[model samples]
Target: MITHIFNSSIVSGPEMLVIPALKKLGEAVSIIFLTETRLPTESARPIEYAMKFGYDVYSVPVNGRWDKTAFLELRNVLDKISPRIIHAHDVKASLYLQQAKRVRPGFKGAIVSTHHGASYRKGKIRLYEEIYVRFVLPSFDKVLCVCELDRKSVIHRGVPEGKVSIHLNGTDRPRVLPEDRNASAATIRKSWKEKMPELPDTDAAVFLGAVARLSPEKRHDRMLKVVASFKKREESGHCKKTVLLCFGEGPEEQKLRQLARTLQLEDRVFFMGYSNTISDEMAGFDALLCLSDGEGIPINLLEAGWAATPVISTRVGGIPDLINSNEAGFLVEKKASDESIAEQMWNMLQNTKQLTSVGQAYQKRVMEFFSHDAWLKKLNEVYATLPGKI
Candidate 1:
């Protein structure tokens, strides 16, 4: 058996990929290896969801990072399943995997980790991240990064070069894009309204998009300020009707909303919080905005790319690799200011005529490279070799 472990993350970026990746794995190997998901206690909903996908799901009753008892509890589960490969998605699980390995010296199962994002955090969280990267991650049999930036970060910090690999998240299968994308923009707009009632009944000519956990790294403040400046600079037309709707939530929500009000953009900017159906919401956006200070490959960009939505994002983490060429999407420097990003947003609006073609081209890139088949193939190879391998 192969086992995948995670914290209580649900309906979010990397966690969302688990089921589909597993499903693809099943198909690829003719269901040769059985797979299971091990989650912490009180993660009933996540366990239930995984069970629906036919993964043997277990909840080990972990109380938090301080819970030492979970290590032995998890070891018991490991003893029962004897998973050939135990892949961890967070710091705590990796620690448990190490403990389980140390105690069972006879165990030959591999321990692997996926460093999902290089997010910017502070204080206790930052300290934890430091420990996770500097200490725990290096011990894993294999460490898969979602982008090259993360792989380089770990290597520079002393993770052996051979242990790291870059693996982009797989996107859902592409759909046949409408030939006249301009005419079909409203179709996406309509889906947005149906999924989210907070949106106005009428669709706007421009829908500026932002989807990420509201945090300093995500720089949602940049998104709001850009919308404010974009509207202030444009005399009329789409600017008058443009709406910058942000999805995802965090401790920074109140701060971002207050910043919007202070910038006199409260009416133009709206926060939609977290959405389980974010994939459905991407198409509604005319242009997706990403200006995070740190990142791996963001789940938002992949979803937007899958939907064929144009993006105005900063070159960070694995983004430059994904948005490698101008034809795929628009990119700004990591240090781009609100004014600079605002200009990009305005330029995109001005050329609204080309939005559909540009978005379609971007979607093509996502399909060609980030498809599930590719992700599954990469995963199987890693799993097969990771036993006493990297």
Candidate 2:
């Protein structure tokens, strides 16, 4: 049996992507999870879902940033399970696994690590990552990356190229039939009107939404600026009234709200905060805007496309690989001026036929490459190549 381990402190796209794939690969596989965050009063929804697929989920407390206690806890778990292969996600988990291996010399499982994104973007590497990559990464039998860009980042940080492999993120097409296009559109419009009661209920109103954390790298402020510019154009009788809906929340929430007010967009921009209903929300939007300064094959893009929504995103990281300019969706160059992003939005708003064509194409592409079955098969292939217990 193949055993997979993961750290789930921050429940985000990476957790969503890997856990589902691991479950679908087969029932014989066992999954063990470790999270430093205190366990919720109730089991996590993701953990519950994995259990239904025959996974054995476990949670134990570990110091969030400290290595000694975390490594000791991990070592105890490894000794108990004695999994045939050890798979760790992100730098922290990988470091703990490596340390555990050192203390328990008889452990025979091949170690595998996956890099989800570039740590350089967050801040200088923490002391743990600095030491781990230089000393522990080379010891892993194989390193997995979610995209080519992330793989390159890992190599640049000292991992050998021969030790790494790239695996693009994937998603399962929704089992539901295609939503009634007209009904879905009308429901979205009605919801927007309720949110912005001052706005008229007409096709003249454009709804733009983005799903991302409120962070410097995500550039939520840049999106607010685009909305503000559009609002200014409307007041000047140069464009239709537009409303911006931003989902997800973080430390930058208060700052972004302040910026919206400063730009006089308080009445036109809606901050819905963090949500688990992203897929349903995407289905209701006219367009999806992604303004991240960097990324690693965001699951949001695939989610939006799967919902048949056209996306306008910055060309960074692995996004260019997923979207074709003017084909699946529009690709705005990074550091694009607010006016440029606004103009792209304006053009798409003015041409409904073009937007519809692109949205349909985007949906087709998602069904082809991001389906759950396709990802499960790929994962099985990866597991087959790993050294297994006889």
Candidate 3:
């Protein structure tokens, strides 16, 4: 059986992508949560969900960064489980697994680590990553990358080319069907209006959405600038009033709100914070926007595509891997000026028919390539090719 190691305190794309796979795997797998730096309460949802799948879930505390206590705890769990393979996700978990091997030399399980995304850091943190990549990572039997770009990045970072493999992210199509979009959208919009009285109740109101954390990398301020530019065009009576609804909460909330106020977009920009109904609410949006300075095949864009919602996103990281070749959506430079974003929005406003056609094509691509079944098949192939015989 495979023992997966990861930090489950946050509900990010990696966690969402992993849970469905583990659920389907049943008793074939188990998971260990490394909560050295986070509260056990934060991991309650993921743990409860995994338990429902009949997978054994274990939680261990690692009190500090580079803590020896974390290593001993992991080694103890490995000894009890005696797993044939230890699959770790993210940097901290991967490092801890390596330490477990040192602490318990008798454990002969093969080590596998998934490099979900490149580290975005500076100063001491960046130096630490450079050292880890050059020395610690090459020891793993296999290093899985979420996209081709990441695989190449790993090879460049001193991991042997033979040790790295690409395992692109995937998602299950939501239970909500395309035929039921009208009713679902109507219901979602009604609920949203009740919660946000400032939102227009009419169907004509253009609803653009960005579903990501309010962080610097997400560039929500740029999204606000785009809205501010769009509002300027509206003031000239050239377009209808539009509202940009931002979902997800993070450190930049107050700053974004203040920027919106400064731009006189208090009425045009609405912050919806976090919502569990993101997939169900996709039908309510005319388009989705992702202005992040970087990305790793964002699950939001994938969900939007599967929901047949047209997306406008910056070409960065694995984003170009999804949108550049497809005729289904628009791509802009990461440093694209707000004026440029406004121009694209203006053009999209004049030709709404493209939205439906593009959205359909996007959904087709997702169904063909990024479906859960395809991802599982690919994952099985990766597992079969591992160095150690299972």
> TM-score winner among the candidates?
3
Q: How many backbone clashes does every candidate have?
A: 0, 0, 1
Q: Would you estimate the TM-scores of all the predictions?
A: 0.88, 0.88, 0.93
Q: Write the per-residue lDDT of candidate 2 for residues 1-390, one digit (tens) a residue.
A: 556666664457777777767766654566666665655532265566567765677654565566576677777777777777778877767777888788756776778887676533544455555666677788888887777777787789898988888777788645223556556766766775676566546365677788887878898888888888777778888656887788877789999999988999877788876677666657667788888888877888888877788888888887876785578888888867888887877777778788888888888887887777766776666667775532
Error of 2 at 350 (Å): 2.4
**lDDT top scorer:** 3
In order, candidate lDDTs are: 0.72, 0.74, 0.80
Residues 1-390, model 3: lDDT tens digits: 888988666677887787677655534788888874556676676677567667789987878678898899889998888888888987788888988889855777888888777635456756766666777789898888877777787799889999888777788767446677667667888899888888876485788899998988899998899888888778888557888999899899999999999999989899998887876577778889988877778888888877788898887778776775647788878766789878877787567778877888888887778777777877777777765634
RMSD per prediction, one decimal? 3.9, 3.0, 2.1
Over 1-390, each residue of candidate 1 has an lDDT whose tens digit, in order, gives 677877654446766676657876653211111122344332555656666676667766655565556666777777777667778875666666676666655666678888877555578877877888898888888998888777788888888999988877776734647564445557656666776666664454468888888878888888777877766665554344678888887889999889988988766787877776767657777788888887777767887887788888888778887888888888888786678767776777678657777888889888888877777778888877755421
> Which residue pairs overlap in candidate 3's backbone?
36-62
Poorest 10 consecutive residues by lDDT, candidate 2: 173-182
> Rank order by lDDT, top first?
3, 2, 1
lDDT of 1: 0.72
